[model samples]
Target: MRRTLLLLIGVFLASCQSGKDQKEDVKQEPMRTPEARKEVVYQVFTRLFGNTKTANVPWGTAEQNGVGKFSDFNEKALAEIKDLGVTYIWYTGVPHHALIQDYTAYGISNDDPDVVKGRAGSPYAVKDYYNVNPDLADDPAKRLEEFKALIDRTHAAGMKVLIDIVPNHVARNYEGKTNPNGVEDFGAQDRTHMEYHKDNNFYYIPGSAFAVPNWEGGYQPLGGEKNPLSDSRFKEVPAKWTGNGARSVQPGMNDWYETVKVNYGVRPDGTRDFPDLPEGYEYKGYQAHADFWADKELPNSWDKFRDIAEYWLDMGVDGFRFDMAEMVPVEFWSYMNSAIKLKNPDAFLLAEVYNPDLYRAYIRKGKMDYLYDKVELYDSIKHIVKGYGWTDHIPVVQKGLKDIEHHMLHFLENHDEQRIASPDFAGKAELAKPAMVVSATISTSPTMIYFGQEVGEPGKEQAGFGSPTRTSIFDYIGVPHHQRWMNEGAFDGGQLSAEEKSLRDFYKRLLNFTINSPALMGEYQDLHFFNKELNAKYDHRILTYARWSTGEELLVVTNFDEKKSYQLDLKVPQELLRKWKLSPGKYSLEEQLYGSVKSELLVPAGGAGEFRIELQPLESRIFKLLRP
Candidate 1:
């Protein structure tokens, strides 16, 4: 009787479940893909962005000159950043690193002053791979939650997040306190005595203890602060190699003394210990790359970093900007990046590789999406801005890097570069207008600007670790010009002078156009040759170039000469006209950048198109061709 009752109940439950399943058979939502748009990365130093203190005190602690927290990146600040047309925000100094500040009360260990760089330590010297800097948190215990909330807020504002991933080296006191279950720290499973093990996290000299370097240049850790751990001594059995590849027991003061080099299956004899990338693997997808490693044995360090990166990605971080990527072997990047992409295909991978010869190898094999164009494009533009290089050389650089031009990221100022308005650089912010135009419009590559660059932040502060010219990344300091725009977190630019406001407005216009223009990502044609021949009055300081796509075209011309204005009658070549198939007629050429200038383009019968331009000193004109 009981069995009969159970059978009847089961039949009734099954009938109800079938009805609910029918309701769930609706149309499935389409999978979303990442949008294809020109990227503009705004690199903001997280600790310094929202700080309103303008004490300008040299070697000051966080108390004397307040530090910016993660909470400071409020909706107003992010909205203002979006207004400036930033697609990605590279929040510098996100990872937890060795610092002089004492966070022992939060169950975090204290870093010795002898091994730390400044009051706010070097961001590159990462100490905990699983956590963010407690200094950036509102409450030290909820640092990770705070960062995750920031990521959510950033996505809400229509911008992606990018943070540094220093794979080449780590802090001298590297630890992973917040690592997940079953995950080990970097050196936990290593054989330290071998010094050449394929699985060891760091290269070490057996039987030697690490020593602190002799102080020089009147500089000391914490500026010779009176502390118990500031005794200018550090102890590490079997001294590891320094970040700059110094294998000495004691590295020099000028070397990267606070950090130790990470080993990536490379031997001390300069030969790879792991499997080499297969030939003709340049264009393979990430799945193929990841599959190649499925059966193969990789070094433990590679797996460890891959896990660390996946951890961040799983925690809602979008991408990484690798620091000193060349220091690590390319094979390791192949393994690590492939694993990352296998998880999330849209992860943006950018690297800092200065060697021009290694650019293609890193991009094709290592799967890097973008590289810094500092040595080639940035150096050429800086020379021109300083009245040294010629505009003719600019076109040559553009052509020389034509194959990988889109992969090269252009920037005028970063954390490591000189500020545009500094005396050591251009001395006047107006001098950068022409260069900024060229840098933004001259290529298909993404353009980056430092945090305070738009408002002309001359980094003339005598901060602790570094002097003026560039903002101090190692010190706890405030940026005066950027603070005026911060306006006590209102982000309204209320205190900016008229000149500063005009400069910022120009930046806004240029950046907005860069992300929206279709012709910028199109094909390029040099107009200098035809312009020089058609008009004898064409000045050498003036540069002319054309970019076009189907139904859209742009004519970009700039005056590099800061002291002279030029009246140019630039002619579009017949070959380009034939390629564009532009008929013999008059067309309107509107300046798209500032939206204040308009002119006419005359295309006569069976001849070239001629456009008259009146360029002022430090002027850049991006004229879009439109049908009349």
Candidate 2:
């Protein structure tokens, strides 16, 4: 039954990916805008990658504030990624947070004495959106300068640079004040006009930041019929409705304590305290919608966010990578995109929207310029490799990748989910190399490489039997383990292990492939899903696709299958297939050089028989076919 389920998943993933394909199918028609140029983006979680001698300097040491500096580029760490031919650097969450950042008042005891591998919290809990984190950019006056310098460095080293942006909520207590001392919540209407008590704290964002032992989820109301009287039990019901009780943001639906369900049309005190909202929205519908965003005044909220983005742009950030982008209204993104384009035309607006379902609309609506490709990671790479099986599901996932090739963000590791040591990676360095390689430099999408990925570091096995660590976004799963290596090597850290060396080399080669390939940079991404049969045995575990640039064609054939072999049949572009040493099977390309440069694979895989390649377990090959 488990095997069947896995097979089913492989097929589904190969076709319709994380809801993004459904959104794409609906086709929201917007007036055509001129296309943007191609970009080869590489993501780095500054702390987890490598500690530069100047940046962190200690290759093995993991700093609590994470590598400490905007210019903290890890040379040995980056060598592998750069070797894969990096074009842009998406340094994930490098911003700093002030000492006063905490949110224990809202609930989860926001205080953990032990630092995870000498690191502070995640960069998302923004101490001050207006200012760069001191740790990332210490020189307050030269903070923006440092960012520009980093970008210059990236460009000089053959890459562009981007940073993450967490806009939804600010740290509970930044600079000893709950609310940046009057930055204005900005979304809700003037409360004084509505005649509400000042000390009530409802409708006002809290002015405290804590370690939030628990991050709860569920809807909260923004504005509603004003409460007639102050009630202490307000903590017991939906605060958005009856002005009630506590709500938590803990992960998983299993957590009931984290939320106090809100009643949109009905108040908790039951006096019918709801108001009419935007056109076509009922009182109940409005409240439900508010819960989704954890914000009700979305109209104004979005406007404020757009302005905030402008402020950052003015500060000279290349652009932003909006966190949990799907949570934001699609309409709001359209507005933000339009506004942002007017200011920073070439700004790189990448979004942390993990699913494939939302990418098209996010991109089409202008809410985001790029999003992570979960399908490619889960079904394409992880399932085939970790699950260790091959079946009819391979081509299905490959086809999905083909459809959304241009705007997808390809990655094997990031700050979220389990570390490389978890079940996903399964402790096999050899498997990780091919898996990481295919993810980073194959398919014509921007590649996002996490900090420790290059060295194949198996992160700590999450605390609380890994549950608490799993749910804690402030600190990712990989940080703990990485820190051990740092401590063992003593702040200035140890030499790279052999496993680390090989893994690093694999990524470097793949990244360089993209940097050198011009075919990947074309305005449009042309991908072909080979092995088109509905039930080929190797179909589920194998993925095959080719990218076509203006004058270049590259194909990437990767086998996530483990110790399984099956007969394969694939379609070939008559023009290019014939041009290459003619063969019937599909081809693959080096992701790093898709559009920057090109290389033809003599034998992309283990050449054993039938003009085909015998792949040893998890293996990936990049081939350059003659351009049509």
Candidate 3:
């Protein structure tokens, strides 16, 4: 009799704890206003977006492998992108960067091939902050005007424009030829003899001259092409630190030797030369941060970057995609971002910060609108899609980031990541369906897609200075799948294969629903954990969740298994049923993504709600509950 009583009491306590957890799960604050739409960013590599060239010759020049001009993004193209549910078009590699091609006629000096990554050059190595890349314009001298026209066209198509702002470094031969009046170039007023100074733009090694890295692994500039600038020589009187902070005159082959690191008032001893933020500043808004820095003395590099950002804002650019932001100090971001917010309060400040520890600091104190959620969500999804990991880890990851979930941007493909269709990854774009659904709708943060992600660009070309698997940001090569969508500049999917078209249609439906759903901007509760415990058939390959607002309730489920279909009973915790005020009745469950499927949700008196779901391999569904 005593043993029976103890067992019964333990079971009752367990049920009560489970109910309490479910109640707490749905108590999160909404990410934004109920009426606000989620942002979808489309990152297009500007020079390669419209290039229809089939000649993907290794180390090919712009003429051989035809480059896409800014004119390529015509009204038709912009409209098509907008129709894909993109709210922002990130025109990557727009700024004037160091390239091997000769633009001396336009008063632009040729960058040494030894320092340039490819004939096209790395976009991170900004050569002229005030000018646009000459290669992107039909008329080289009118590059900035062409970019401005592109920005205007993007806005006219109902999408904002985003461009790169590489604050951590610049090209080794940076020359601000088109700088605005009263503005001087970086390092112009530097005290070169000193290694570090608050006023100096770059850190120097007092007694050494810059030397080219020793090419190894058979790697050479332009694949050993004989050019005057490729003679293994670059003239710098006093060697400055390499872009990746390599404090050597001769950086290794793997180091970022082509660019020089920009110093932001931090000494070699790790002491800050700038003023620190006041206590309680992290919880404050951008306006308060800006006010705090208004009367303080800042570094010269800080002032220069602020001017560059403000100049672009004046020219109608909506926001920036800061590169390698974590390497730079958060204090610098607080100062710079606050200034940007002061000018354009609605500016989208997305940063490439990979450190999980710095995520909150960058978003809170640094005032960043979004930080790349690469370290957590993207990695977890990649592992699961590749069939090596379980879906159960996702909820744990989300729980860890619950406080700042809305600030972490999600992406499956970016310029730096391998293509989903590449052999190194899932090897098929279809395999990423479930992952994409979860990533876009799992949080209220923004969703970003690379240029050819929808069409499953494998990025297998061996373009010079870049390997297979990932798209080459350094070479002048045409993106094959993206080019098919370009369809001879028709901006239609006239040449896309049937499979590609289907994949693209899937993306369109998913993205459009995300931007239009109020539930996505509302409270979320994890059904995955609940189902895992209550449903006998629920497995680690499946994930389910609930999102709801005033009049909307969504049950999202995904099957990551590419080989198996599931017929399982998915459960909604008792506390969730109570919160929904759903009392012992059958509800209509309609699919929102494809709109061709429906399921039944049955709630029994004194029990959890049940969803009899049939999920196919690599499939995802967003079901809406009809209360009738």
Candidate 4:
């Protein structure tokens, strides 16, 4: 009886193994697929990303003001960010900068308070290129390794990582303690006697010494706290130029005195000391720019910055967001970006250039992949949301940039912009829903959102450097709303209100759809004219447009009016009907977002398709066509 039982058990195990092998033979091969649509970047202030503290004393010391650390961004936190439909995670303020905090035991020097902006220094005023901010790491000695682990974790969560590259300036007390063996600090090989030289790393005033600005208005360095280094005196002969190119030894208090201007062979006069690009070089590619700089001699500052950028890239950074890119000469960018692309052709390069006229020049010549659309789209949307502008200007902005619309990255808030929920701005976060829908769907360019914008983080703190309405990038403080979502590093929205959770839900749906849609990267057509013809009472605050690709079509309409609801008979133009080859028929118009909302479209014999849409104040709808 025992032998018979053993033989039956062996037969049963063999049958199970044969079934598993059959299932494996029929399994499909896994493959990597390209991203379907344009990317979405979520910008997070590294110091404020995970801090849960609420104590925000003005001019507080580091202990009084707790900070977020690199370890806070573990696998679970990163997965939550990825689930939010983000393609790139921009970790702002990651570099080692001059701050009032003392790190002397680690062989690093503390910054003088008269120069540093806040207890935590400005991230743009970089102190060392090869090292990260020690304040961001649990183990200060392992800061760089911690950041590398962050990069690895971000990639593991299927998101790219970007950090800042402030090429135009560096900290006033620039030091390179963690630089590699062959690297030298800026100004280490400079000739300080001359005002300008082709190879000098800094611009200098001819015959003056650096002077700290005279203080007034109840403002003192360290808020009147006496320190051994806060004697209010910094010694310097032949003062270097300020970050804003202030030539005087005594720059105004408002000037960027904490940083020094980098010399890129641009002389005190308005002439270039290095070789200029060939005429019409803006239309060329990175390879052409690379060839142009192949045999040319560049300045010392350019070489230094290139080395710094390449060092970061070699450490697995996907890209860089350039701060004050226009302040540096375009010729240097042509050389630097070419070298970068040669190393990593798919690197994402974004520049902060505000001038509208120089947009094309910087994009085409400097090889920048994207630029902040702050002055145009963001400004216009802000006015419209503030009840100062009309929706008619939206088409004008889009038409004016028809040729280069793909290069503009849209954003409603960043480290530099005011919070949308601030009283100085729209005073209501919900009022931005329509504007965000338009910003994300209007063009093929990318879209970015600040860390707490979705949960309505009001920048109302009395931090040291700046006032309310804009989050202080200079202070060590907690972002209240985002911290709630963080939930003591759980990264769950346990403390969020019902309204805040709903707002976040809307954002999730819209952003997830954005990353999955193919028609978003296809052709666009404005339907405002056709819809206006359908009803003279069609609200001027309402805008309509259409986007279509080979097998997909989408019609997007937004109501920007916060005080009035709108019900209009929207019309599709005859030109579009002929192009789409739809005859007289009825079709279902299903709302892509909030799938329960649906409408019907009536196509008359040889004419346009008309549909009636009712939108609440600041409501947006993305309708997809389905067969009747």
* Highest-lDDT candidate: 3
Query: Candidate 4, after superposition: displacement of residue 240 in Å?
Result: 0.8
Please estimate how well model 3 matches the true structure, expressed as its whole-model Cα lDDT: 0.89
Specify the highest-TM-score model's number: 3
- Model 1 lDDT per residue over 57-152, tens place: 788989888899999998989999998989999999999999988899988899988888888999999999999999999999999999999999
lDDT of 2 at 515: 53
> lDDT values of the candidates?
0.84, 0.45, 0.89, 0.84
Q: List TM-scores for all candidates, in order.
A: 0.93, 0.63, 0.95, 0.93
Residue-level lDDT for 79 in candidate 4: 91
List CA RMSD, all candidates: 13.8, 11.1, 9.1, 15.7
Q: Candidate 3 — which residues are off by over 4 angstroms? A: 1-31
- Count of clashing residue pairs in every prediction: 0, 84, 0, 0
Candidate 4 clashes between residue pairs 3 or more apart in a chain or in different chains: none
Q: Indicate the worst ten consecutive residues by lDDT in candidate 2.
A: 236-245
Query: Per-residue lDDT of 276-373 in model 4, one digit per residue for the tens?
Result: 67765666778999999888888899889899889999999999999978777777888899999999998999998776766766677778888999
Q: In angstroms, give how far residue 172 of model 4 lies from its true place.
A: 0.3
lDDT of 2 at 553: 56
* Residue lDDT tens for model 2, 295-371: 43333445456666776676556777876565434545555666677676677777765445556655654346567
TM-score of 3: 0.95
- On TM-score, who's better, 2 or 3? 3
Model 4, position 114: C-alpha lDDT score: 77
Count: clashes, candidate 2 = 84
